[model samples]
Target chain A: MFLNMKTAVAAIALSAMAGSAFARDLVINFDDLNPGPKKGFDDAVALFQKENPDINVIVNINDREAHKTAIRNFLTAEAPDVTSWYPGNRMAPFVDAGLFQPVDDVWEENGFNDDLAAIKPTMSRDGKIWGVPYSYYQWGIYYRKDIFDLLELEEPQTWDELLAACGKMKENGVTPFTIGTKFLWTAAGVFDYLNLRTNGYDVHNALTAGEIKYTDPRIRATFSNWETLINECGFVDNHASMSWQDAIAPFANGDAAMYVMGNFSVDGYKNAGLTEEQIDFMPFPTIDASIPGAEEAPADAFFIPTNAKNVEDAKKFLAFVARPDVQTQWNKTIGQLPINSKADISDDKFIQEGFALLNGASGLAQFFDRDAPAEMAKAGMEGFQEFMLDPSKVDAILERLDTVQAEVYK
Target chain B: MTHAAVPDTTASARPSWVKRNKLAIAPWIFLIPALIFFAIYVVIPIFQSLWLSLYEWNGLYSADGESTATWVGFQNYAKLWDDPNFWTSLRNNLAWLILFMLAVPLGLFIALFLNQTVPGMRFYKSMFFFPFVISQVVVGLIFGWFYNPDFGVVGTLWKAVFCEETTNILGNVTFTCSRPAPDILSSPEWATYGIIAAGLWPQIAYCMILYLTGLNNVAADQIEAARLDGAKGWKMLWYVVVPQLKPATFIAIVVTVIGALRSFDMIAIMTQGGPFGSTNVLSHYMYEVAISEYGERYGYGSSVATVLFGIMLIFISYFLWQMYQDEKGGR
Candidate 1:
């Protein structure tokens, strides 16, 4: 009787194996445990599952920062069919190593070439697109509207105007800018905006790519402007001790007038008790008139791993997510701009302003950290922070950065 | 079949074989699981990290893909010589080692004070032990807030004592101290010291617990004898109490050294080796190079790990040798 039971169990297991073989399963590793992003991802996955009932979808979500370290291990050992990641030079290492599958065909099939054109260069490396950017957000000056009103200050449009506004703000006993550089990346945002404003997008790209030296005259010009800003319009005292969230306290308390930050930080400002009318967004003031304005917009993307067990299903999911409606809904829920131009954006004021700002830009440079190689980015941000803290250290900081740049590029 | 001719002799010898080998075999059988675990988790990884240090790898495709790690020999070590961060990390490590040694005496002092019977002494002991019970990350965070220059206790105290009320540029009231309050974590010169102070809180507690147990085992007769010999206070502690507490002191010193060397968590939580990477010890620096958001230079990180391992090996070897000598003396 026991031998008969064993044979029966084996038969049932064989049938189950056959049943699984007949069905296709796709594993997706998403990185965002926050309510909004998680809901958006889950809803998208549910939609995909409903549309394709035959396909079994397994969704694994993790904390964003944890995912950064976990991806390298998972992509090789237990490869997920699809994984979320950042676009730009961030994905370059994995792409160069051939760990990510090039999904140019999906882009072509979904007509993403036209839709995702703004972020195409970022998502592509070596002439093939490695991932699909689902959402991106513009970085610009987020300023206190009440402070500007109280000081009778017009929103600064030109460098001289900005300097004048900063002078007024300083005269009234306010620090012109508040930033937290403890984590280092906030400093990079300032540097990117300065470089983009001073020398424009091409120089910023060339500099990040190591085609130009840190001590180059153009780069020096950017640093010169930064020094002037630091002297005339000081950041909050003790910025190096604070994180980005911590910096918001002063901004909320009305001690600081402006912050150079991404759209994602708007929620933080609101949560810190600032109302919509109290805060307003502005394009980074122009430094050199000859250089057309280019804003910083870092994008998040998804890729199919090369070792994916179900490539077809992963591609289908990618294509589904790339659709304009899906992109619109997903981005709307996450409060980020969809890469697909046709994707309908939220009527939220900040979203509208970001859309206008990003759309009108001559070019988009991914923020400094995302643009440069990670090692160089780290050193560069540190230099930026040091320069902010002590302007006299500009030359030293730049020289040190040049050394790191040379080492990293080599 | 041949032994059947000498059946009585063979039967007697069979029981003798079991009797002779049982002690030898039994201990090894008991040790097998632990040995297997140690080999897998500890022994193997050390050699693997050493081997990896010889090759340049990004750690992604090197395992299975076409892009294999290139054998770079000792080039990673060569690069380390030129790397300023490495030197800074080494210096900071030395600082951690030297500063961390203070915990041993501090622990012993606290233990001695608590050894006396007093009102609610047990409660006081537990309260003193609180820092050690809490995780290092929490201690780092608590100290981080405590040291904040704006709203923290230190900042508030400084402002109250030394500053006048002034409005900032944005028309908000804030303190403008006559002498700017030191932002400890933000200053490269002070950041390491600040983190080390946070680390010492729990470490001192740990040492206190060790010494407390040792103090419980202290012989009453010996103390009386020392008192009869007119050895009291410092003299009693120096000649009698400390001598009896040698084992606890040794263990305390060994653990403190190891803790100092592995001082990554507090630094990671408190400063992240920042304000220009000033607080970095070798382990944190190794992590920054290998796997932090900065970049992955696995070969270089492995080289750093190898150097750290070498430093630790010296201490561990000395400790083992001392133990061996003590064992031999006991025999």
Candidate 2:
């Protein structure tokens, strides 16, 4: 009689468990190393778990470096229902191979199409939406306000005025520009800005895509301007030997004055124990006021695999994450602007400035690594480093880049 | 007729087969596990790496949407031949090899000094041998920080003494006669040499311990005998104590050569082949191309790896031959 009673209770418990597991399985893989993003990810996972008590949610988190190497493997085997990937050409080859699921109808159905007009270009290719953008930050100059004040220089609005300000900073015993090119991509930040200002967005895109050659007269002018920066206004000392963090040592010491970096570095500066008032942010000075197109746009997006078992769930999650409230919460935790227009943001000073700059962008091009194919971007950046070290090698470097482009594209 | 049932084992009837071949056959049984381990770890991977060298891959991605790699044949090898970076890496390897040999004699001299039995000599021996027992990674990092020009101890010393305007090395500078101390790790021309010097720190320590052990076993009675016939100083040391150090010198050379070739970690830590690929040795360069980042030229990277393997094989074969000659002579 006692055994029979125990069996009845066990059966009831088992059935209850089965009924609860009937909820959808949502698997998410995220790549974020910073503290803010990690918290945002954990908070979102908690909320998501609470909302769907029956669903079994699994989160796979990985380091950013490991994620870059693992992304290719994950796409084919043991693929997460949804994963994070970069935008532009980094997405192109994978998209072409049918490795990604199309989220277009979701865009139209979930109101993302009408609401996210600014980011649709990042998510769109050939009229089909491949991914959903979560968050993005503007790239620009982060300078030392104290040094500028000491030199009696106001923020420069024109190119010539910026150079004159730099000249004054140099005379007062401060490095006009400070960056670590030991890893080489920091130099590309300078180059990309110059290219955007010199040739506008379409031509910059064309150059990276191999449709235009580096030796073209337009590229030559960009190099000429770059050479002028290196020659006339010297950059930080020993830039070749330093990583980005190592370069910050000089900046924190007030030995160097300016760094052109993404908003991601704001937290790093704060962690370095600098007062917020000491540092200031500004956009790259415009080259031609009349030359138009996306002044700056580099975004991070999420996409679904073409071979996924849970496409419906994946699209639903993408749509769910795209909601204005979700965007607002995630971006607030991550210190970046949300892609959604309706998200209510804290009237934080930095976000307000970033939003104004973003909304006013004449054009938006993906970051160089995203805008160009992986192979071309890598070779081009290596050339950028070599060009900076010795401007005389510009012709050779351009020729080599062209050769790499021909081979890589083929 | 008794051996007919088990010819290999002596047919079991004539007093047990184990009695006849126990010396020879027992050894094979004893060595089986070790041979299996060798086959599993060391022997098979060599042939596998050789085979892998023929293909191109990102070391990620598989065919079924699982980061699959595509196979490209001689394209990797062909590209390796065309790459300027490959050539630069090879040249740097050769440079490392040539310079790293200096540690052997330096180690010998230090070992000779520490071989004495004065008061607290054991403590001195341990102190001298300290660098070798610690990890190579730590050694590399210490040297890296030590070479920092701004706050590095060596730099500070150099600046205080050599850069003093009152005592300039080359007195021709205008106003400030002091020239700055060299940025050893930063300059491409000297960066590989800097890493080699760092590598030598542990290697010298290693060689010193080996020589100390060899010296302890040297035939002292023979040295006393040689002294009876007027052998002294340079002659006594050269014709007598030097020859007895053959075993230690053999190990010292083998390890030093192998250490010079296996320079991946130190290079990775100290200088990542920067300043536009100036200090790249073949090993690090191959890794950078084959695996790091989204580097997709697996085939070309493999070709460089194969070429490095071939060079190492030549050195390994020669070193083994030398060891074989010594063993046969000693026997």
Candidate 3:
């Protein structure tokens, strides 16, 4: 009796697998912020659904990091026809393994070269396109304009001006900056920006990709500047225990005068009840007297997986998401700058500034995690956190990161 | 022989009935379902995990564009031998087990305090029992906030009184505390202790609840007899109550040991083995290697998990053997 039941169940399970394995259905599994970025994804899904009604579209939206863990499970169990992922060294291992569908054809077919130059390298792995560029934004300093005016600090134009602003903010009993290193990646924002400003964009990229060691002189210089900011200027109080959201509380209360953050932080500021006039944006100031290039890290992107059941439909979805209307609606909702140059932006001033800087950028480097492989990025970010908490352990931390890189590379 | 059997009477029927032995075979039928359950959930998975530890495959490589695994023999285990993160995790697990054992005695003391049959005793017992009722995630969140050095309640209290001033039990100034109250989560020296302390909050509650139930079963006749023999205070309770509470003490210690070793949620929530990865226990570190932001070192992670499983197995085997001996002695 048990054998009969087991056989019946096995047969049913097999039919379920066989039912969906080769269907023309195009399922796009999206990972974006719920209730906000989700709207953009839904809008795109609606368009694709309308365009191809015959194809069954499955939309699986998950919490951001949860998607990272789930991606592995999905690849084996029931991979979506199309899904989103990041680019850069983050894609290399997967690309090498053939997990992501190469979308060079999509790029060329859509005239991606003529316009989206700023976001090309992000989607490119080993001189070939492995994913489509959905959207990306520039990152920089978000500070309170009213507090800056109160302290008689103009928008910082250079390194000295920035430090002067920090000093003035500190003098008035306001914490100069607020950042939470509890999860360790916020430290990456500060580190990447500093590295980019110090040694230009290429060096930053090379360093993250493990071509340069953490103990390199240029890397040491970045740490020195990071150390100066912590030792003399001071960061927000009790940053080690706070999450990124918790850190926002101090900035929201105006207890802290400035926050070095991504352009995405604008929405958070608006939600925190700060008027538009109170919040303003600026480029991360150049640290050296003379620097080679513009410095900005691009945040958040999308890619199609290699195991996609319907490549043609996946390409169609990718191209559709790249359209101006989609980009405009998506960026506005997420409070980030659109990668598409033709996308119309609203009267939101911070978005305008972010757009301007991103337009004139000499180079666009993918954010630290995207630029570096996952293992290296993990160690690097942890090292940054440790250095911030205790600079004395810099040598040991760097050495450990170097050892991990050595093992992970081969 | 059949022809002879055709002449059967009551005596022949009685012989056939005697050989059947139905009562002796009944228990085997009853044991079959539980045996099958154990075979599937317990035995199969253990062997599978061990076999999987011999090969390298990202849990999701096939979906992402990667393929299946390559067998690496003992290479994964060899790599673990040289990995500093592995050593750090092992040290942290040991620290948790040692420090978290403090809960048993502490819980016993609290249980004794509330043992008095007075007004609102049940209320006090229930209040003391509250921490265990909440889930670990909530406990982790609450403790994470508590350890916040900026605006957390503990942080505020540390700043207000524990900063430089010292007070006696009666609140008189005795001397001054020289050093600052350490930043518990961030400091390498104290991060493990902080997590262990967080774990103890609920664990002590669990132990207290067990002991409370144990104390109810303590014999009043024996206590009165001991009292009549002039046994009182420390000696009386030690000899009488403690002897009666042996069963509870054994279970409490066993749970406390397991709870200490199994502390993963609080550490992950509070610190991701950070401030130089000082707070990593075996479980969190294993997860980190297996699936830390797409870390695809599957064989390596599994080996770490296997080591953790092995250690747990040693303790578990000893415990089972002890139970077996006790059962035999009881028989």
Q: Evaluate all candidate structures by whole-model CA lDDT and list the values in order.
A: 0.89, 0.77, 0.77
Q: After superposition, how far is residue B264 of candidate 3 from its true place, in Å?
A: 1.4
Per the 3 Å backbone cut-off, how many clashing residue pairs does candidate 2 have?
21
Please provide, for model 1 over A1-410, each residue's C-alpha lDDT reduced to its tens digit, 9 standing for 90 to 100: 35324433543454354454327767788899899998898788767766776676777777899899999888888898999999878988888787899999999988899988888888889999888888889999999999999889999999999999999988877779999999999999999999999999999999999999999999999999998888888798899999999999989988888999999999999999899999999999998899988999998888999899999999998888878999999999999998788989999888999999999888888888889999899888888877887889888888988888888889
**Candidate 2 or 1, higher DockQ:** 1
Runs in model 3 with CA error above 4 Å? A1-24, A48-58, A299-302, B1-28, B63-67, B159-182, B292-294
lDDT of 1 at A88: 79
- Evaluated with TM-score, which candidate comes out highest? 1
Q: Which residue runs does candidate 1 get wrong by more than 4 Å? A: A1-23, A50-54, B1-5, B13-19, B62-67, B165-173, B219-222
Q: DockQ, per-model, please?
A: 0.49, 0.26, 0.28
Task: Identify the CAPRI category of the predicted complex in candidate 1.
Answer: acceptable
TM-scores of all candidate predictions against the true structure? 0.93, 0.88, 0.89
| Total clashes in model 1, counting residue pairs 3 or more apart in sequence or in different chains | 6
RMSD of each: 5.1, 6.5, 7.0
Sorted on DockQ, best first, the list reads 1, 3, 2
* Interface RMSD per candidate (angstroms): 2.5, 7.9, 8.8
